[model samples]
Target: MSDYDVIVLGGGPGGYIAAERLGHAGRKVLLVEADALGGTCLNVGCIPTKALLNAAKTYEHAKHGSNLGIHTSDISVDWTELQKWKAQTVTTLVKGVGFAEKKAGVTVVKGYGTFDGPGRVTVRFDADGASGSGPAQRAESYTGDHVILATGSVPVMPPIPGAKDNPHVVDSTGMLAVDAIPPRLAVIGGGVIGLEFASLFATLGSEVTVVEMLPEIVPFMDAELAPMLRKALGNVAFKLSCTVTAIDGGSVKYTTADGSAEAVEADVVLMAVGRRPAVQGWGAESSGLEVSGKGVAVDDRMRTNLPNVWAIGDVTGRSLLAHAAYRMGEVAAANILDPEAHRRGEVMRWGTIPWAVYSIPEAAGIGLTEAQARAKGGNVQTVTVPGAMSGRFVAENGVKAPGAAKLVYDGDTLQVLGLHVVGSYASEMVWGASVVLETELTITDLRQVVFPHPTVSELIREAAWAAKA
Candidate 1:
């Protein structure tokens, strides 16, 4: 039996970060993880996907650079070399996480942990545990003053005939570890995962088709901007309002919106419908933790129904992004360290959370969309500015490239409610927009703020000036 100030299950972004903060604050911490230290984000999900996308983007730029007065002959993608680089990158980051945890004086246990009761967990050390800095015992029970659940999520596979046993069909994880780039790729689900892979393979000379059950892709995005994004993704076809029915060998069969049966041939098929919170198989029942279909229920302070037990990240089914998990970890750690402060301490500011899709032509949005803002029946107004307004965007991407910024705000108060962008640096620039929303910066306030000249981010300032006009 081992005892600590806190027992953290799952060393993903949320879990490891909370453990690190707690341990640094002088709390004895035991961080247990069944897989890699950096979790899916650093391993399979975010890091790997972005790495491949970045490589694809490089290949695309080299191929298309003739328009920019740069000419290169025989530009080709070396898949083997690319995979090696990706592997090296993931390895370095994972080792960095392990080093950080060790530096914070955290006891690392690489094993499967399950809750036996509140603030009590039984860890099963299988083969993965042999590599950890824990006891040699095959199984051990650890008790702590507090328990934080950050088990994260898993990919969801929908029941489609022939998809279950098909060798060509793969999930996002399988797609990431693909042995070779398929000549033809069919992606189901027009969400972030599907579109990103579609953009990647298409840029790499694959005939890519996206079949979505909805009328539009990225339903949460601004409706007017959705088509612009679709147009920006070159050489990719979209079949919206379509349902995938079966996977017949390398053919993906689906029903169109008009109930017409259609099929597309592919060398590989991606099942990117979505992911579900990993609420099962972690001994939630043993601890009697209250759970919903979404995930582990937690208040704004990241506290569960049970005393001294908290949940964050995908397990809570709140914001599942790694960055959101990072913020949630900080909030949970602050509250855990000062329990007496209660609601006065740090709490999650969900409205300020931002989301981004890393495609060739990236897209990012923060806060409510135009429709969402109007749905609230407030005095809503919106303003849009083209990326051409920025000298840097025009110089780099050219005037023909698709790029725009849209801002949603209260007409009466002029408070910025949302900001959406589709173009280069969208992912990098959305954080500033998030700060604008977080501070409730009005259009007037935003206009008064000086923006660096000749940058893509200046589009936000341009949009603010347009809103004021």
Candidate 2:
């Protein structure tokens, strides 16, 4: 017999949400987290980076708000104060997680937990820290009817020389905690993470150069719109279709698309190539759980090969977004509570997911990309409209940094296939965008949904209007 109904092995968006749902549903849950309560998303990844980005955005406004008829002088960034504010923000959220777990009656064990064997786990408690609700024990074993693995991913550094073991090199986590912005920052990948950092440091008076191996940055982004974003990130230099050959102290050498070589000087190099599921130190071999190419394998209900064993979030390597993990957890938790009474509608659906990159000109997308739609052997039609077409976008952002909204639809059926938006409020439009696509709503259906006036969200309707035209 299992000691508990559910035992969550990580406290990320997936793990915590699963634990919360299980705990509230009257299931005995023990949440084991080696680090802080919120895991990487709270402690290092999303929240902290957004904090720095907000500070950078504010600094940009003060320095460049002259065109907005605002005059400001001597605007500066106090790295120390900014770091403190970021830390406080993280602490507040961590404490909230603790409170939530307590309120929901979840016993949170502060320690590194690993699979001891089937239906079992061993946790090594921290002697100096007290995240555990129960009395501390250096080593203890717990058995559960089911286990949910939500161990998050870590930044990946490429195979280039000096990418590691170099004092000047930093990953996403290290970049967040940097003492000061480098005067010359060379970002070795131009995906979301790299561009976000490039945007942050570039706006903070740093000369930022982005080097990407792909022909274009933001690889999976809408093809036409990605270049516009590259243009919007005007201050940062981009070396697309280039491979980083080596990182020799304070400089990065690269080979161009034509095989020509070039180099750029840098004070710091950020390796934001991508992230891989953290499958290490989790006792995978001993547990006998199945692991796929990159992460733990899971099914539609977020179930693994082992009976009643589930995994979610980046650990699944399915959808890396925090929101994706939350939805995955919701589905898993429902299925875990009662296998026969699983929430049918809550099954994890990949296409319904929305994505956002928090850059100066934010990018958001939902459903299939235009290419994906065409690849499905369907008659696809797409409408591309400027952000300036929206009254609020024009009024608030002016025409200086205009972004676009594009809707990809089935020309034969008139069903919306995808919606992509970029600009000032694009980051805030994903949830509503997701709802429209998730419901498989068409132009006729969308036309009936009234959008509030003078809002950037109207760009959705505007793009839809153009799609059917």
Which 10-residue window of candidate 1 scores lowest in summed lDDT?
127-136
lDDT of 1 by residue, 1-469 (tens): 4499999998999999999999999999999998889888999889988888899989988998999999999999878888898898899999999999999999998788888778799888755444344554588889999999999999989999999978999999899889888999999999999999999999988999999999999888898788889889868999999999889998999999999999999999999998889988779866789999999999988999999999989889988899999878888888889975456748888888999989879999999999988889989999999889999999999998899999999999999999999999999999998889878899999998888887899999999989854
Summarize candidate 2's per-residue lDDT along 1-469 as a digit string, tens digits.
8899999999998899999999999999999998898878899888998988899889987887898899998788888998998999999999998999898899998888887655788888656754345655578899999888888888887788877799889998899888897899999999999999999899888999999999888988989889989999999999999999899997899999999999999999999998988877788766777887678888888988888788989988898888889888889999987775455576887888888899997998888788888889878899998988888888778876659999988887788888888898788987887888778888878878899997999988888877764
- List the RMSD of every prediction in angstroms: 2.2, 2.4
Note the clash tally of each candidate: 0, 0
Candidate 2: residue 337 lDDT (0-100): 74
Cα lDDT for residue 135, candidate 2:
56
